[model samples]
Target chain A: MFQSDEDRILTLITRKLMGEATSSELEELSLLIADNPSYEILIQSLTHIWNTSPARDEDFLEATFLAHIDRMKKNGCDFDTYEQEIEAKRPWYSSRKLLVPVFSLLAVVAAFFFWPRQASVNTPVIIAEKEIKNEISTRNGNRTRIQLLDGSTVWLNAGSKLDYGKDFGGAKREVYLTGEAFFDVAKNPEKPFIIHTNAIDVKVIGTQFNVRCYPTDKMVETSLIKGSVEVLVKNRGEKWVLRPNEKLLVENISYQPLKKERNVAEPVRARKVFVAIKPLTYQNNDSVSVEAAWVKNWLSFKDESFAEVAQKMERWFDVEFEFRNESVKELSMYGTFTSESLQQALEALEFSFGFKYAIQGKKVIIY
Target chain B: MAAYKKLFHCLFPSIQNFAFSIVKSRQLAEEIASDVLMEVWVRRLKLMEVANLRLYLFTSAKNASLKKLKQENRFSPFSLDELQVEFISDYGNPEEILNGSELEKKVQEAINELPTRCKIIYKLAKEDKLRYSEIAELLEISVKTIDNQLVIANKKIISAIKYFVRKKS
Candidate 1:
């Protein structure tokens, strides 16, 4: 790579800031700055920026530590054993018991109120409240299994959030979902498990199914793995029962306003939703249905366009895809990726689809 | 145990921030940080054989955060590029040195606008005080890449400062 002198000086200055620059490199950097008096201010400012450290909130950290200790004790961590071990190693004069009073005082202080003092520029203050709303979320490239108090399990896919009130499983077993999740409802016929999404509300007595209702997706999908499920489209108030191994697709009517503008002549048609019931997708010789493969950690897709697959991959791998070639997005892709690195998955796609792709930092550009 | 508390005070913030970059949730990050530190105490005898305790803790934090995401059933691979790191650069002394808060805001925005990979590299090098070789090893990138990313970050900050200087003159 051809390096510019300015870039070279900046690199040397960075190395110096990180304490990685050799004496010769330091001399070279100084000489470069001396030659160009204009560079002095830049170098100084950069150095100052490098040396500057964020202010720490001692009070907040102390409160957090106290809370952490409380949680550890709740989780059955034997701090007394560790304390005895430490006491055996050290003399009584140097015992940790000396600081025990200070910690107790701090805990007393924290009990009144502990507000986060160190507020960063962009981070919003998250109030750590135990009651009110209980929310669990997973970021992209991650999945999590959550067990509710009702003995039901939910496998939350990436880029998903499940929110429930504190009264959950009390009067009604209801949850609001913003992305995709697989649910195994406990056998509670008295309390129907209901999931409220933007497009539809799924009600079930005791069943196993997957609900995908991402805000950006065109259709809300409900794939039943076993048992039965009842779905109600919010707009039309239409209800349908889903049997085992059946998938229901309901057009996301939230996008109707945008579509209404494009088809003003068919106003009645615009208000209607396209509903379809089909068998669950399965790859040849594979026991796992493609719809539920994500629960098993398999990124499976069958006859989905590259654009659609890219969206899934975005959540699956946490990388944004930019298609430079429009025609390539329409190419149909079929495969299952299990435990493959992002680069490896991309390479496999490139080989199969005959498209060139570049993996930048968190961005995958395809042509 | 006192030594352990001291270690917790020393390493908690950075580890929590590192976990926060990956999980993008404050509560989860805190849990992961606490879990990582607690593991050190639980497995102290076994961990004695491990070299580079700081790096080990960092690696543990990273894995713990990712593990929170994938859970037991999934086998998704993670890349550092996916991390949306929140770089907190101090504006206390630098504000007076840079002349005004406006320039400080500009510098802050510039730091914020740096590429995610660049931000992580710069943070690991400068804030976390990790060596270039250590950062390279942790991120699975070459030392030269870390060097280049730092330069890019410094260049961006310099340009932001230069813009303010130019506007004044």
Candidate 2:
């Protein structure tokens, strides 16, 4: 197609507007525009239009990015692992500054655990042999189900930890728990699965059970769903056998020992470790027990006080709650929440309890 | 990590818009954009060897969008003439320009009436700030074609302004 000079000038001008024109092309454009002076206004208008930027909603963009991150996580892309892998791949000299303190802290912990005694000085050397301990933990608002080497499956609730040695499932099946978990022990007559907690130990041959031993809770609870298990209270040195649908509650001795030390002046009241056996809580014909509902992604509470439910909600939603009015904490609440967002949950609670609450970032203030 | 986030915020919308031009679905476009950006993170070390990261990302988005269309059984080998490209421009204060809102409206209408290929080229050049060669590489066309299409777009808008100028005189 034969192009006119007018069309040629516009092409060069467009290139010039986009900063794509060379110095020679620029000179050619300027000369062509000078010859057709009437094109000056059109060129100026085009430049003005090109310079104007489209309106952007930064907050919307940020929200979209965060949602994208969530989708990535749901798709099994763990960014935290990638970050650690990248850090590990960095040059040693560059990583040494950050690794030094972490290594020193590990050394101190190791020394405390393996300190040599006068008679057993040689034992420290044997104990220093590397024993790989596998630890799996879940952050608040997240739950994980992991299968053990023994074919047993364990579901860890939010804000829980399950630690086991590398030799687990070989000669001994033992795990240390700091929070809540549900276990379905694989049947192994030779090895009894044992869970060690701060206040008690749960021993079972083949059973389905749930254990709740959060550090913030006042008691340790073991709820057996299908099979029998034995619960040993550490402070009381008593073993209680639990039948199916039985739940044992033992007062946490970790906090009470410190309280007893503080109140030494008082007469020694025989504070036998408070212990009780009760039936597992079931809600309105639901086969799933309230105690183990979290395994199924439901946060269930049965006639629990608002204060107790708030603690559960904190882990379930990864939020901090501040109760401004003390009376609001004592209000008995009962409900099951599965997939409601924090805002919707709060609104439902507000409608029923008539409590005023405000959510600021990750903190919820109740009055 | 901060650099990755900065890159995401800077490039996501533009990539999404480009994909939207091909897929014609906002949700699918956003998904394609996310997938493309995530690939950058996945291949961060390898991508450092790429000469033009922006062009690489745009090309990835284009391929992903076309793949998504194919998955949905809507794939037709992309023809620039068949694509519906949306061009959005912010004329800050129309009254400050020559002959005010009438000319601005005319310019907008002219942009709307532009051929699909011409509008896409114009948008990539003006809004996305892509060079002529980059646009040519992304769209799989020659730089001469881009140069001519851009002239066609500009001539249409300039004639809109000239119409108003003639009427006023």
Candidate 3:
């Protein structure tokens, strides 16, 4: 196959050693090697290097072994004789206190093995009501805000508590609350919201509203900010519809029938009271930004007395406040101020009134 | 003192002789063997599951020495592989020797010197043990191409050994 003498020679020599060669060239090398042994010796050297190339690296192997030993030691697997020696000298195991654990373990074993049979035979089953999952309780002056999975947000005012659970199962999104909170609920027409307070249940859909039910207060109030709500009384079965910007204040009172009239009865006129439930309102003026002013870091005081402000400050600064004279409670203020510093806000109130006040300990002596 | 004693035991005595047999230089063998062993220590994590630790370690050293020879020979025309004298050391007992680093290396160099087609066909025919027909089927060329690679690979190795042998004689 080779054309020239040099190519033929190269092919012939390669074939002679039985190393590697083309079939035609290989036939020539065999002819050459069969005639001469010198070429065969050269090919043996090439195969020698090929025999063990994969394993020629030594230090690579040693480093590999030492690393394994180090890893085993790192795992705290060194339970050597030193630990045994320390344990053998300890005297606490034979003490009576050790018997307590043994008995306790025996009691637990007894409960697992025996108690269920006795309880199943003796006690009747009573299904208990399940509790709501999510809860929020705000501190004295802070607004606790939470966004539900449905993208609805509940802003719990100071001294308020709220409880809700997985949004809705089949019928409606229901929540129970105490104290005061404002809710901005997402509009889902298929699922309406119902809030259960101590006095009444407020139900709505696609609405923003506030519910204030202070235990000490004489009335429970619900104020609709954007949409509609219906308040239902528990025993009376009375339903009151409150519209946007309208309010409802139901007195915390016992249901009493009107006193029976004694004298001559005049013909009763067609009554408006029979048709419409009387609406309730606290402010003769409009409700302003003061509703959630605390969320914006503003202390909104509307016709708030000095005593009321002092009560708030005491909780905010973790101090006790005492007024020497009762008339300090009569000095009321109306304004909005952010507390840059606790002392500065208090000074601003004092500055507005031009009143003399002393701060000795937590007691404010205002004259 | 304890650390020094531990290191003394950890050191492989087989490396120098093994490297010497491959690269055919005592000094280069020692350096290659030690460097390979140190690197083995650095990357010991990989060989945690390896069986036959001693054989494994010495083989790594032998590879390092052979690599040094190949790299050095690439630039300068000098090779430590003097053929006839180095043969017995290169083809030492596969079973009896703790490592085959020396022999593996010489085979590699002899093949590295082979022409392209010779290297491939020889690799296919001998190392892979493919028949002429099998190699032809795989390469999809004529059996002549496969036969040419084998012939060239063998002849190149044969010539390299002859040079070494002739120089010694």
Candidate 4:
């Protein structure tokens, strides 16, 4: 046989890798490997590449579902109902919630144990169906305007995502928000627009309000520009109504991971949702409200700690910050930046706060 | 719609990546894939009668991607007779194989560098795991074309791996 015949044998081995080779082809492959010796190495190399290829990884599943849900929503198709239909039909996928996370955790632990061993069990064959919802996410230093079907306009802040189902505006208009958004809801007496966040649920009827509820932030704020919105605090079931130009700051006490004991799963401490309604701060000679400054592409903070400011800066500039000293986190700062480069912003902060910061690529190390 | 979602979750990545290999843009590939899967959903009643679901999806993705290419004025028409396989001397370095992530990336880049049709064939056979006959049936080409494309793809992958190894050394 010629060199080209050996290539043909390798192609047969490729067929074997894909479970497409016949018994005769397998026998031919074995014969070729025995004869050439080089064919064995070729098969092993190719198989290894095939098995561990990145294309086999399921990282795009979440993204694909998001995009699919967006497409489905455009067609007036309800994804939630579609999902429910699938769940109702498939008995095998019934216990997916409990089974999937456990399997994923095991897969993670197994990956750690078998990292060097190159175990084939690294990939799990679990098909978990997470609820598909339409999601729009904005990165740091970026803002977006989303116009809903109900003629409501939402100005989404940097590093925010607004998720709503296809059933939005049909019955009860509700949207799940992370980070922050300024909602200018259309007047609808029958259907009240509701915004669900980690901290509180803001229900509005023809209202314009800015809700800041970053998961990492300590407080969830609902700053009303005009009209009224009823805010319901989670875990406590306490409700507070906010008037125009009034900001309702609710302490995000529901998700206190540290309050829970290390071994215990449920938190034993009595969580309290503290509510405080205050007039919106008019800054820069009453030209801008501090809470709504971000909507105008201006970064503003009042009496916020360095840690809080660092979080805001992270979103504002899309740069990661690391405080070398813990004391650096506690330093108090109140400042507003409008159209300043990240370096200039940091320089202003450093001059006033008397701290040193070094920019290393996309990271800032503060001392 | 239910069956479409099930089939979608199962095979989306393969279809999307296959489209990506052709379009060279993730966003366009995703759009093409979404369009193809949406068509499946729209025609769910008729899909059951189709002989092969995987072949149908891959074919749809390929056509949609090609159509998108033509619209974008990036379409360069060439025949399969123009294909010339290049062979590389094997370094077969152990160091190259051990770094899984880097090697996987190099392999993906290699697959990415193949001529459009050959890349799609390689992805179908290797990534999507479609059979030679299935690929031929989907592309409406002969089994010999599939074989030739796969051979070209394999040679290119080996060449890429060796190139990475040589660059590293």
Candidate 5:
């Protein structure tokens, strides 16, 4: 883009210094400045140079001054007091104190520019207290459904234990959940309903959803069926939230936890899940059920991980499962069964996944 | 400072942001900031023609805050805890959700302190409902710059929010 030596060089330098140069322009300028100290001085001098016929020092200074004005105009920046002080030190310095006001104007512009902003007082304070005194356990053959005091609905999947609800408090609303549960919350503004799993705190005001939070699986999955919810969990320190229809699977889970997996996480000292609200597809029916299968006392799955289904199976049958080939973790199934038969469901699963099994009372074994 | 009173009120809703970061003590913050306001009245001339009083107040507030902390250091050492309140409602009051408009306003103000380019870009994209290409043309830049600006802007905003939260914690 250069034509002459001095004028072309100065023009390019001015553009580059003002941050208007494109990537290639910037690269060329950088390369030139890198090998040549004189070039760097020349560029800086452009700001100090005068722009007049034969360009006297005063005129050159005025031209440079005009360039700064135009660049700032394009940039919409005003003068600061320091610059005003400098100009005040000049023959035309009176024009510079106006610089402070202008800089103040620029500060208004900067207010619109800087990151440290004056944001309103209503930043939503996320408060979580997941202290539930109960050590809940589920049996393999039964389904448990509970209506939380907040009007949120939860269906405890079979064989899964959810430690929840002593009560809700003003600054915080929380429940410690383990294994799996489907949730339907009643909307509330003043307080947010939260579920603290071993890894995250799932939050909502009023929304219908299901969270399969068993650590046994490779991931913790949350499925939203209605309304909106925010999943706030500390990921290293930052929290996150999930919106409706979006399913989040935390894939960083340890495989051993999914093994004879008793309690997935420590039940305390974990992160919060974070999700955001987005536009949603309107529901066709207001009566949509998040726990349609288990609410009616049945273990239901149209297509879900077999291990997840097995976790439900363990809860319903109140049994422990010992898998011979840990590879059985890959198989998934979709089927629903009433509490009518944990034995039949296991028999069907054994037949489909192609594994050997034995039932020693409540414990099921496959080798 | 008298000239700033109106702007101060407008900035007041947002001052908690700077105050939280500086004071480190809410009671001391509220008190000193009020003192700062009185000082604004007492030394109006020195502050007169102060271009960005938001910046000035913030700097003054911050200096006053540092002084207060130093004074507290002259006293005893201590630690406090969360003011745990009983659940006003077992879950939460259903009525809070019904009142949605207030939350939206709060969300908007929180969006304000973003970088100017980011502010313009976000407002153009969100409020005036412009396309990226349209924004690029108006600003004479690349659409990608606008996107990057948003990421940076979101980071600053998110941190400010967390700063407020951690102050209480």
Candidate 6:
């Protein structure tokens, strides 16, 4: 029980803030504040503080959820098997319809691994005349340089795969990218080059650009360096025209259709997606854009949070990072690392950020 | 699996905040919440045996946060008098605090200055928008105790603001 009048008043204020106050209590509070002008400040200050606390911040909670999902997957929770179990109970036609696109992509990927290339075999030039689909992949902790048949050059980042059809330079120059790459296409007015990613389609006419759309990332980013590009967001019917030194970011929120009401006739629409366009960042005292710096093997970031930087480091070094301390995620970092070993990079970050990290086998835990 | 994911989404934010209030560190709070959820996911088949999932989650978050605090050597056993003094005193300059359009920031800092248990109860009431009875059930405390803690939180916030004003004068 609140014995003192001041204690009772404070309790009433708390009740009011929680929307639990009775009408009599509300009237009493108003009278108390009216009788004493200073009580007005007390109420106002408490209200402001209650409303502005970081507990009400949604961004932090969203990041927490994403981190939880990442941890669960890392622990080998077998989410795919669980998903398959649910999908198996669905109608047979529904599952069959879903397999069409997947099977086609698998066929393309299969052709890439087994087809014999005339350049590799000394037997016959007939294989060279036949149109051949080529697939180029960079394994973990490695990057590769590739020159296409049309003299275009591509620098593929680590853990990335790019596949092109047989008629690459004939009528349409198109490539499907699964991870990240920097593309420098040769000029060809008759054919429009397209870079197809899972989230968006980047169409260009012989230009240099960077596309980063990792499956684990929450957004797809495309930064143009030398020429123009029109980015078409899949199923969104939205197009973004990007000029040189421009970047487009598309948030990857998948569409979840209504299940119970399957008979309703509604046009397929993208549900509440987000996109942002901004100027590409330029590294200081250099002509190169920050987005395209990976082409030169320079790991550079400008004002990126530690969590984001950690993801990049994971792919760059092929190591697993386990964050034991959450406060370190919000720390903003900016630097350039070129050819540094994983330990050296971690050491540099530790010195700059004043956080202690321990390396055990392939896992780096920051506390 | 979608049902499990939905449950996780609905409950994680409040549980994370609850842990943060106990630990007073964002990283520890996130880790605690994630660890609790990981346990739930690993023993998902046994989840049906638990009658009250929300209370289970809150308990897990609280125990894990306290354990981590102890492990980090940051936990000091508290007394009622110590908590009262902590809730009522210790604030810095007004000139640095009372800046432009940062009244919200000042208020947030005041909330952060609250005693750990008081802050957690206030968040359960205000931020999570849980009813007093609901929070009492989750924390396994009396409803009257929840009411007293919320009042303590409001009083401490006002005291912190007054501390700034007196310093300015």
DockQ of candidate 2, scored on C-alphas against the true complex (2 decimals)? 0.16
Once fitted onto the true fold, the runs of candidate 1 whose alpha carbons sit more than 4 angstroms away are A1-3, A87-367, B72-76, B88-90, B93-96
The candidate maximizing TM-score is: 1
Compose the digit string of candidate 2's lDDT tens values, residues B29-96. 99999999888777765654565667778899999989999999999998888777875335544324
lDDT of 5 by residue, A1-367 (tens): 2324333344345344333456576556556655554444333322221100010133433353344345444543433443464345431212333344333332232122111222222222122345334445555554566655556666676557766545554466677776677776778877888887765668888787777666555556666765666665445444556544456565433324643456655433354333333222211111122234455454555345656666666766678777777776656554445434556566544433445578898787866
**What interface RMSD, in Å and to 1 decimal, does model 5 have?**
24.2
Docking class of 3: incorrect
Question: Compared with the true structure, what per-residue lDDT tens digits does model 4 show for residues A83-189?
Answer: 56545654222233323322222222211111122212112112123434478788987777777777888888888999987777678799999889988899998
Model 6, which residues run further than 4 Å from truth?
A1-133, A253-270, B1-169
C-alpha local distance difference test of each model: 0.75, 0.75, 0.51, 0.67, 0.48, 0.67
Scoring model 6 with DockQ, what do you get? 0.14
DockQ of 4: 0.05
Q: What fraction of the true Cα-Cα contacts (under 8 Å, chains A to B) does candidate 3 also have? A: 0.14
Residue A67 lDDT (model 2) = 91
TM of each candidate vs. truth: 0.47, 0.46, 0.35, 0.41, 0.35, 0.42
Off by over 4 Å in 2: A1-3, A82-367, B88-99
* Candidate 3 chain A weakest ten by summed lDDT: A113-122
Q: True interface contacts reproduced by each model, as a fraction? A: 0.40, 0.40, 0.14, 0.08, 0.04, 0.26
Candidate 5: give the TM-score of chain A. Answer: 0.47
Across residues A1-367, which tens digit of lDDT does each residue of candidate 2 receive?
Answer: 1247788788887776765777788678777877887877777777666655565566777898899888878877767776676567742212324233222222221111111211111111111225554888889987888777788888888899999887888789999998899999998889999999988999999989999998767788999987789999887789999977779998876543323225433322246678999878764323467999888677778779998898899998999889888898997766666566788567646644556799999999998
**Tens-digit lDDT track of model 1 for A273-327:** 8899987876432346889988867788877999899999999899998888998
Clashes of 1: 0
lDDT value, residue B3 of candidate 1:
45
- What TM-scores does chain A show, candidate by candidate in order? 0.61, 0.61, 0.49, 0.58, 0.47, 0.60
Lowest lDDT sum, 10 consecutive residues, model 6 chain A, at A113-122
